[model samples]
Target: MIVVGVDGLRPGVLAVEWAAREAVVRAVPLRLVNVVPAWCLHDGPTGAVADIGAWMRNGGKSALAEAAAAARRVVGTVAVETSLLGGDPRRELIEVSEDADLLVVGDSGMGALRGLLVGSVALGVAGHAHCDVVVVRASAAGPRPEVVVGVDGSAAQTAVLDFAFREAAVRDAELRAVTAWNWRDPLGGPEASERALAEALAGRREIFPDVRVRTEVVEGSPVDVLRHAAAQAGLLVVGSRGRGVLAGMVLGSVSQALLHVAPCPLVVVRGR
Candidate 1:
């Protein structure tokens, strides 16, 4: 498991919480990574042209230290590792994701405008990482007991279902599997949409017998339905294609809308 490390704002601490939660669940070590611009090596603390990258390296180390401490507090001192990636932050994170079991990131800010604008690094990594990605936002007032996932019947559907079921099992929470379509005469009718949702989750039940799943087929936009369902959820899981033009985009919306609207943590599964 891996978590993004940064200096300030909610992500650093939030990432630690989420990554630590998974670490506890999977009994795995957590790795914290901070990506720095390679050019930072030229920046000097004395305002000089360059500091041989010492400043950047030290900064990364400090962030990793804070993140590690937070994770220990959250998961009662679990095994943790740290690393620093040079060059483009987004590219480096994507590379780190290739070997990580899961990747967690924080939204740049909490303001509506800020949240809506997914950081370029987060956007890039979410779309390209080989592992699953979870983006944390808004603090919770209390514990939420449900995990919601979207089913689009795309190639990514299986991975999304598996991820949702596994997470629900891990959290001992109810899984709400949702599918939405534009309301119309037939193609968008509730019956057909409900059947599609059932088909999409067909064999997944056998695979995850312990997970209790409730299916929902609503006549509305996919993102809107998902946003509504996630109102009381602890996590919202969605699927995205990590390759080509759709890279990092969640449900054709680029992850901006939900990241801004959903009051819970958002997990964007990189689909096969």
Candidate 2:
């Protein structure tokens, strides 16, 4: 099942709907989760404290019901489930991601502009979640979306490529395999670079024998190359680990930059 976390269900509703529809098309179950802040039900010294708490809970439940109904509308006959959680959104999402095949969340929520500079829930889940994480931006438009994945010739990248290829085949969209190289060491020689590129793409032709596969080997930063590629893509997928990010608590440079600047929605495949 693909679990989608909806916080307040604002601007993210469209992206969540699109993701749920994609899951339905893949014949996977869809689960919608809404996290309610505990402070919303806190009892203050003001009069009618109990009444206010009850009202807040009721409002939260109503909003969750509406989000669930909207999801059902987008996904015709797909299996759907809804849950209203109370606590930190990231913690709740991580707890639920245990049994899920994919976890989806919006890049940012309502009132997030003044609150968080970079989307926290998406980054948190992408960094620590055991399952694949899909972070949808506010301006994403769906329908036969394209899949873009990064390849760095690492074992983790192989898993990312496999996932991207399968997703492209299922969606009947183009899959772009990208590799970024920097010409820092001139003594490395072009022959070694060519051999490395070939090895990176080798042994993967059988995965998409008939699908369109395009590779790019450019001389620049990975983040810049990926951001450029993301301009024309519908979805961008990348591995959790790469040649960047020393601490490993967050996404690498390319993935992190794309998360904030990608023109389309982004997916960070974890545990690959």
Candidate 3:
């Protein structure tokens, strides 16, 4: 099943709805989840913890019903279910993600201060989710759907490419394979860098034989280059991190930045 985390059925709910429709069309079950913060409890004598819990449950059901209705309008009939959870939104999402085929969430919510800051829930899920996570921004639109995958010639990149190609196939969109190299090192000339990129992309051609594949070798920061390229893409896919454990632990700067500024939906694949 594809699990989507909803926060009060905000405007960003549309993104997850759209993704749910996509999932339905693919014949996957869609589950809408709402997590009420644990702090909603009242510790004082006047605190109405029971009342608050009841309200949250009722609200959760209503939100799920609305989501289901919206999804039906687009998908006709699909296996859909809803749930209300308690505790930290991020932590709950991570736990629920365990059984999810794809976990979806909004990029930023009601308190967003900037375009670059993914909501805390999204950040936590992107960092620890055991499944694929799709971060959808409210400002995102259009359907020119192109799959943009970041490659840095690491074993982890193979997983990224695999996911990108498969998504492009499912979406019937163009697959763009990108590699960004820093030119600060004079020892590796532009020609050498270009050669390396070509080699990396060349290794993935067989998997995407019928898909229209394009390769880009840019000479700038990976994050900047990727964000620029993602402007016209429908989906931007990248590994949870990159080449080494350090990159994974720190969150690949490129993926982090793209999650914030990319104009399209971002998919972060999690694994070693």
Candidate 4:
């Protein structure tokens, strides 16, 4: 099943949008997770604590019902479920992700209590989730019809590219494969970038020729370039840096940028 974390009263509209779409594509059910405070778990479920627990559950049910209603608006007829857990949203969401096929959350300018669902909580889940995670930053400029993916000449990218192509095919949208062009090196300029991107796309054509692919070589940091491309696309795909860290070249930086500032849904693939 596809799972999404909602902020309850405030909610994350873009997250619901992605969860609905992804559930439709995967032919799976959608699960919404709402995490409240941990006061009752520590204080025990008795007396005044029991009253508070009921209140928390009521609020959680209300919030989850709102999120489920919003999801229904998108996919029309799909199975949607919800769970209300106590404790920190960040830790609780990581646990919720254990059984999820894809985890979807919102980008809520985290760092404060009000933004718990999308901020630090969302980022932590995306970075550490065993399953694939999608962070949604609502698109303000109407509907974007295409999907953009950042592809560098790095290991495991073929797997990530395959993930992007599959989503593009599911959306029946145009796929743009973007790479940061290095102009300082004369040997690996635009021509080099073109070749690398072509090689990356080579064998995949036979598998997903129906996916209209557009390759680009932009002269800038991968984070900046991919952000620009994602601003106009419906979704942005990138591979996690795994363990290593690279400044502007690796997706570690790109993922950081897009996780907070992207205009569309961002998918960070952890595996092929």
Clash pairs, model 2 backbone: none
The digit string of per-residue lDDT tens for model 2 on 1-272 reads 88887766554676568667878777888888777676555656365766776776786677667777778788767677888777877888899999988988877842255556356777777787879888777765444366777877654776787788888887788877777776663424445555665676677767577667777766667778777777768788888777544863466766666677766777887863
Report the alpha-carbon TM-score of model 4 versus the true structure: 0.87
**TM-score for all predictions?**
0.85, 0.87, 0.87, 0.87
lDDT of 3 by residue, 112-202 (tens): 4464467767777888887988888776554677888887766677677778887888777898888777656442656776686677767
Candidate 1 residue 227 Cα shift, in angstroms, is: 0.9
Report residue 187 deviation for candidate 3 (angstroms).
9.6
Worst 10 residues of 4 by lDDT: 109-118
Residue pairs clashing in model 4 are: 110-119
Q: Which stretches of candidate 2 lie over 4 Å from their true place?
A: 38-52, 110-117, 142-144, 185-194, 247-250
> lDDT winner among the candidates?
4
TM-score, prediction 3: 0.87
Error of 2 at 73 (Å): 2.8
What is the C-alpha lDDT profile of model 4 across 1-272, one tens digit per residue? 88888875332666876688779889999998888787744556788778988787788778788889998998888799988878888788878788888888877722235634347766787777768888876555227678898888767687689898998888898999998865764438888888988998999888998999999999987778888887778888888772246654424766776777777778888762
**lDDT of prediction 2:** 0.72
- lDDT winner between candidates 3 and 4: 4
